[model samples]
Target: PEEQFEPDPSKKNLVILGTGWGAVSLIKKLDTENYNVIVISPRNYFLFTPLLPSCTTGTVEHRSIMEPIRSITRHKQAAVKYYEAEATKIDPERKVIMMDDNSDVKGTANKTEVPYDMLVVSVGAENATFGIPGVKEHSCFLKEIGDAQQIRKKIMDCVETATFKGQSPEEVERLLHMVVVGGGPTGVEFAGELQDFFDQDIKKWIPEISDKFKVTLIEALPNVLPMFSKQLIDYTESTFKEEKITIMTKTAVKKVTDKTVEAEATGPDGKKTVEVMPYGLLVWATGNAVRPVVKDLMSQIPAQKDSRRGLAVNEYLVVQGTKDIWATGDCAVAGYAPTAQVASQEGAFLARLFNTMAKSEAIESQIHELSSTLNLKPGNPGEIATAIEAHEKQLRRIKDIKPFHYTHQGSMAYIGSERAVADVSWLNGNFATGGGLTYLFWRSAYLSMCFSTRNRVLVVVDWLKSKAFGRDVSRE
Candidate 1:
C-alpha cells in the first residue's frame, strides 16, 4: 500500500489558485517536495481553452480537452493537496485565504481559511459583457465546458423549434440566425465552427432550413484579428466572404433582447446607425473581465489601485506592493497579452524561481550550520572553511536568477471550411500565412498543446469521429 502523505511543518505552504493554464503549468513543473503545495480552485479540472470553441460545434468533445487536476497532482514527487472550492478573499496581512465550497454538495464545514507562506493568483478572467443590457440573460458565453454544452443544445433546439409545424417565415429566420459578437480569436473560431456545422451537416440533414441558416460575426473593431498582420487579416476576410459568413465590422452591440440584438454600426462616412437583428443564439466573446477575487485583492494593494486590467506585477511576476504574492495569466498585468502561451511561460518561470529560492535557502541553512560548528570546535577549520566557501559560491550562482521574459510564439486561428490563419514567428522573423495548410498546422499545433497524452489521443479520436460521422447534433 502507498504511504500516507502529510504536509511538512518545516516547509513553506505554497498555495496556488485556479486550475487554468498558468496554475496547471506551474504545478506540472514545480518541485513539490520543496514546499507544502496546496491547490485551491472552483474547477477541479484544467481545461484546454483554445480548443473550447471546437467543443461548441462538437468538433472536439469537452472531456477530451479536460485534464483532471488529480491526474496531474498524483504524479508529483510529493503529495499536493487540492481543494475544490472558490477563493473568496485574500488577506495579505494575515496571509490567509478565505474560501467557500460553492458546489452543490457540502459537509458541515463549507467556509474556511487556508494560510500560506506564498500565494499564486492565476485565476483566469470571466466573460466581459460590458454592462450590455439583456446580454447576461440572453447571450451564451464560450468560456467553460458547460457554456459549450449549452450552445450545442441551444443550436439544435433552435433548429427543431424553427422546423416545427406552422412556423412563421419571420420566426424561422430569427431562429436560424446565429449572431457571434467579438472579432477576437474566440469569437472568430466559434463562428467558423458553427458555420462549418451548418454547411457540412445541418444543411445536408435539414435541407428545409439550409438557405435560412446563417452565421453573422459582429466586431466593434474595424476588422477581426487585430493582432494578425494586414495581409493575413485580408486573407481571413476574403475567406469568410467565400464561406458565406457575414462579417459586420465597426459594429458595436449596444443591447440584446431574448430574440434580438441591437447594435450601432459606423459607416465609412463616419455616420453611425442603430440596427436591430433577430437571432436564436447570441455568443458574447468580446474579451475577459477581471474576476471579483482578483479585483478585491487588487483593492487591498495601494500600488495596484491604478492598475485597471488586473493585478500589476513586476518583471519577476510578484504582485506589486506585496512580497509573498504573485499573479499570473489573465489575472495579471504582466506587460503581455493574456494568452495561453504567455500564461504557461509565466507559470514555468515561477516554478523555476521557487525551486531556485528553495535551493538558496537550503544552502544558507547549510552554511549557517557549518559556521556554527566551526565556532564551537575551533580546531578543524580548513575543510569547513572550504566547504562554506563552495556553498556561498553555489548560492550566488543560484540566486542570480533573471527576471521573467515572454517570448512571442505567434498566433493561429481557425476560420472554418478546413482553412486557418497563422502569423508564425520563425527564424527571428514573422511569417504570416493563411489557407488549408495553415489549418492543418493549427490542428497539429493544438493537438501537441493538449494537456496530457490521454487528452491528445481523445482529441484526435474526436476529430476523426466527427469528420466520419458528423457532429453529434442531438440536443442534450
Candidate 2:
C-alpha cells in the first residue's frame, strides 16, 4: 500500500490565503513539517506580476510566468492540502474561514468552512476604478492573465476592424487609438510595450494604417513614474516624446465609454478643460483597491475602521487588534508601497517569525518537562539541570527576534526602443541610470527573480523567439 499521510493532530493548522507573491514567498521559506499547512486560493498558480505587461503584446507568453501552486507544495516534507477556491468570509471569532469554489465546473459540495489555528491573509488587491462611470464595463484591466489575453485579442480585433474595406477615416482612427490610463509603472510599461508592438510588428504587417496608429498615456499627477527620481522621470518623458507616444499629465479620467474616454485636463495657466478622446483599446492600470473579502474582515476589526486603503498591520505584520492572524502584500498597509519586492520581503519575514516561534515553543516545552523530571527523579538532577540550562540559553537567543524591517532594493521599469530605467541601491548609495544598458540589467534582474529555473529558461526563450521572428500576433 502507498504511504498514507494525514494532518498531525498535535500541530497547529496553518492556513494561507492566495498564491500571489507574498503567499508563495512565505510558502517557499516556511518549514511545512512544523505545521499542518493548508492553502486556499481561487487561482491554482502563482503569477509573476512584474512581467505581466509583456504578455499583453505577446512579447512574453502568459504561461511562462505562471508557476503551478501544486508543484510548489508537492516538494514539502509534509503533505500540504490545497483548495482552488475563493475565501468568501473570514470569521475571526469562530477562527474559521468560509470558502467557495467559484469556478464554472463545480461539484455538489462547493462551499465549506476550514478552521485554522493561524491564518494569513495575502489575497492581494483589485484594480481601483475610483467610482468612474463605465470604467469596469468598458475598460480592460491589466492585472491578471485573463486580462492580458483579452487585451491581446482586442488589439488584433481593433487592427483588423480598422483595416476593413471602405472603413471611414474617423472610425479607423478611433479603432487604432490606444489609450492607457494611470501613470504608474504598470501604465508606463504597458504603454511602452504597446507602442513597440505597433512600431515593430503591427506596422510591418499592416503598413496602410500605420500612420493612424497612436498610443496615449494619461496621468492625473503632474508627471509619470512619480516613484522614480527626477532625472529618470525626465528621461522617460523625453523618450516617450521621441517615440511619438502622447503623455497627458495633470489630466483626470472622468468617464469611459465603448469608443471614447472623457477627461478633464489642467492647463499651465490654471485653466481646466474637458475633452472626449476616442480610443479602440482603453487599458486601465490605476493601482490597487481593497478586495471585498478584505473589506468585510476590516469591518469586523475595530482597529481597522480608520484604515481606508487596506488592513493596517503592526510592526510585525500582525493584523491590528488581533493575534494569530497576519496580512501581507497589497492587502496590508505596512507603510510600504504595494510592490512585488515589498510583498516578498514581508512574506519572508513572517516565515522567519513563525519558524522562530515554533522553535521557541519546543524549547519552552522541553524546559518545563525537564524541570518536572528534576523534581520527580532526583538521581539525574545534575544532568537534567545542565540540559535545561542549555535549552534556556538557546531559547533566549532565538526569542529575541526583532520586528519586521523592509529594505528597499531598487526600482526598475521598461521603456520602448530597447531602453529602460533603474534606480538601484548599491553599496549604501543610489545608482540611477536609464537607456539600453539599463534595459539589459532589467531583463537579467527579472530573469533571476523568476519563481523557478524552468520559468527563467522559458522567459529567456520567449525573449529570444520574439526578437528573432517577432511576437505572435494571432488573436487568441
Candidate 3:
C-alpha cells in the first residue's frame, strides 16, 4: 500500500487542489516530469462556467461543457494521480492535507491525509447567500452541473403543474413565474436563457400557458452588471425590456420562503417598501464567498488574519505566512475580480515560476557536485572554471522569471432575444458593443474557450440542435 501511493524520492510532490480554471491551467502547462503531481477535487471534471447558464434551459447539455480530469492527466508526461475527494483541511505546518471522499457510496477509508512538498490551493469559491434565510433550502443555485439539471427539471415540472387539471388561474400564474436574484452576468444570462426557452420552445409546447409566463430579475444595486461598462449595462436593460423580462433595480431580497421571495424596493423618492413575490422557480446567483477549507487555512496562518473572502497571497501567488504553499483562482485575493480570466493567468504564472525554481535547484546541485569533484581531484582549474561558469549561466537564466501580471480581456453577457453586450479593450481604447453582432462574438469567444476540442464540438452540436429542433423540454 505504501509503495502504491509513495511519491518518488528523487522528485517533489506537487499537490494541487480543485479542478477549476486555475488548477486545470496549471496542470496543462506544468512539467509533470519535474515533480509528482496529484490532483484532488470533489468533481472529476472541469466545467466551462461561462456558458453554464445555457445548461439551465437545455440550450446546451451539461455534459457538453464538462472535460474529464482524467482526459487531462492522461496527456501529461508523467502519471498524475487524481482523487475524487474534497479537501477538508490544510496543515501548513506539517505540509499535509486532509481530504474526504464525499460521494454517497463510501469507500473503505473515506478520509485520508497526503503530504506535499509543494501545495497549490485552487479550490474555487462558493455561492454567497449573505445569510439570507431559506436560500440554501428553497432556491436553486447556478454554480454546478447538478444545479442546472435541477433547474431544467423544475422548469418543466412547473409548466406541467400549472396546466394540471382544475388548476385555478391564480395558481397557474404563480407556478409560471420564474424569479432570478442578482444582476451579475450569471443571473442576467440565466434569466435571458430562461426567457429564450420560454419564447422558443415552451410557448410552442404549451401555448395555453402563454401570456401568463413571466421572468423577473431582481437586483439590489441601482444597475445590473456593476462590472460592465455603462453602455453595455444600458444595452442589457433595454434588451431585457424588449424581451419582456422585468428588471427590478434597487430591490434587495430580505428572505425567501417556499413559494415567495420577500424583497425591499427603493423608489425614486428614496422610499423603501417591502413586497412579496411568488414564483415557482427561484435562481440565486448574487456572488461568491470563501470555502470552508480556505477559511480554515486562513485561521491557521497569522498573516491571513485580515483575509475575509479568501486566502491572502503575495505577488507570486505564494500564500502569505506559509512556505511552499500557493493559492490561485477565487480562493486567492490577488487584487483582481473572482473571474476565470484572472485565475488562468495566475495558474500560468505559477507554472513558469515552478519550472524556473526546479531548474534553479538542478543548476545549484550540479554546481555543488562540480565544486566537490574539483576539490577532491585537485585537477586543472580550467575544467573546474568552465563547469562552474556553465552552471552559473543556467542559474542566471532560471532566476529571470517574472512575477504574475493580470491582463483584462473583456466582459460579455447574453441579454436574451439574440442580443448580447461586450466591453472589450482594443488599441489603447475601449470597445463597447451590443446587440446581434456582439452575441455572435460572445458565442465564438466562449466556443473557442472550451477546455477541449471534444467539449467545443459538443457545445456547438448542442447549439445547432437547439436551433434546429428547439430545446428539449422533457422534465427529466
Shift of residue 65 alpha carbon in model 1, Å: 0.3
What does each candidate score in C-alpha RMSD? 0.9, 1.2, 1.9
- Per residue, candidate 3 scores C-alpha lDDT tens digits across 1-476 of 11234468999999999999999999999998799889999999998999899999999999999999988888877788999999999998898999999999897999999999999999999999999999999999999999999999999999999999999998998999999999999999999999999999999999999999999999999999999988888888988998999999999999999999999999999999999999999999999988999999999999999889898898999999988999999999889999999999999899889888888998999999989888888868789979899889989988987778898988888988988899988777889999999999999999999998899999999999999999998888
lDDT of 2 by residue, 1-476 (tens): 22235788999999999999999999999998799889999999999999999999999999999999989988877778899999999999999999999999999999999999999999999999999999999999999999999999999999999989999999999999999999999999999999999999999998998799999999999999999999999999999999999999999999999899999999999899999999999999999999999999999999998999999999999999999999999999999999999999999999999999999999999999999999999998999999999999999999999999999999999988889999999999999999999999999999999999999999999999999999987876
By TM-score: ranked, best first: 1, 2, 3
In model 1, where do residues sit more than 4 Å from their true spots?
1-3
Off by over 4 Å in 2: 1-5
Model 1 agreement with the true structure over 186-214: per-residue lDDT tens digits: 99999999999999988888999988998
Error of 3 at 194 (Å): 0.4
Q: Highest lDDT: give the candidate number.
A: 2
TM-score of each: 0.99, 0.99, 0.98
In candidate 1 the C-alpha lDDT for residue 47 amounts to 98
Clashes of each: 0, 0, 0
